[model samples]
Target: MAKDYMPPSDFLRALIDEDVEIEADDTATIKRLLSFFKDPDAANRDWAVFLLGQSEVDTKAVRDALIGALNDEDDSVRAEALVALAQRDGDLARPHVLEALSAEGVYPTVFEAAALCAHPDLIKPLRGWLKATGDKEVDQMVAEAVAACEASAK
Candidate 1:
């Protein structure tokens, strides 16, 4: 006899609840969560995509999906993707984050990306941005990233 499948909302929560127990076998669950990234409901898609990243399952598919989402039209989706990419590979995401920062009207996305970076080298570019644009928030965030990078280096 087969077990009954719960509805998606409940299922997702259940998956999260089971995260600790099944931590070692997240590959399959991550794939299943990735499928929801295309859901019509932006909230569902965003949450699913975010959860997939949190799984931290190292695989080509996960990396591709996160990279693709970094360009998502939705700002939150893009932010989540940037954060995931930062966790996966900070060096790889640096260029894209820097490009976004230089683009006008892209500060929010750029800021989110920079927050994820936590790399000291990002301080140079971020400092340049601060000097050029005089955006205090970005400057503060970059300062925090710099601190984090410095602490990690020690």
Candidate 2:
């Protein structure tokens, strides 16, 4: 959008792609990515959170960064943080997800994180939303969240 808005995720895929070799240290990459969570563009923040969630780094700085993203002004960024936490650390993500889900108008994005975390608490809400929202895309995500939570219970 802007002349200088190079997304923090542009070079990150190279590190995550497996096929692409990382030319720099992983921590540097992660730290750079962490800064994206605060970027002006919501898309950049969302993309950074998504990629960060997929990463396998276990450093404290990374963990703190993801946790900090829950406070983001953009809903999508907050949602992406939840998904990332779910992917990278489900146990750590539960309370935050529950807190976020307690509010209304947080669907679809929240569902993505809940689906990944697979917490049984999400099943009822997901099911209710599945029946309520006629939007196909949202229905799919709700159904997936239900299935994921149901599957985890077993």
After superposition, candidate 1 runs with Cα above 4 Å error: 1-10, 16-24, 105-121, 128-140, 148-154
What tens digits encode model 2's per-residue C-alpha lDDT throughout 49-124? Answer: 7777766666677778889998989887788778877877787997887777677676467778888788787776
Task: For residues 51-124, write the lDDT of model 1, one tens digit per residue.
Answer: 66676575778778888877777766776777777778878887777766666645444555676766665666
For model 2, the run of ten residues with the poorest summed lDDT: 15-24
TM-score list, all predictions: 0.67, 0.76
Error of 1 at 69 (Å): 0.6
In model 2, how large is the Cα lDDT of residue 20?
41
Each model's lDDT comes to: 0.64, 0.74
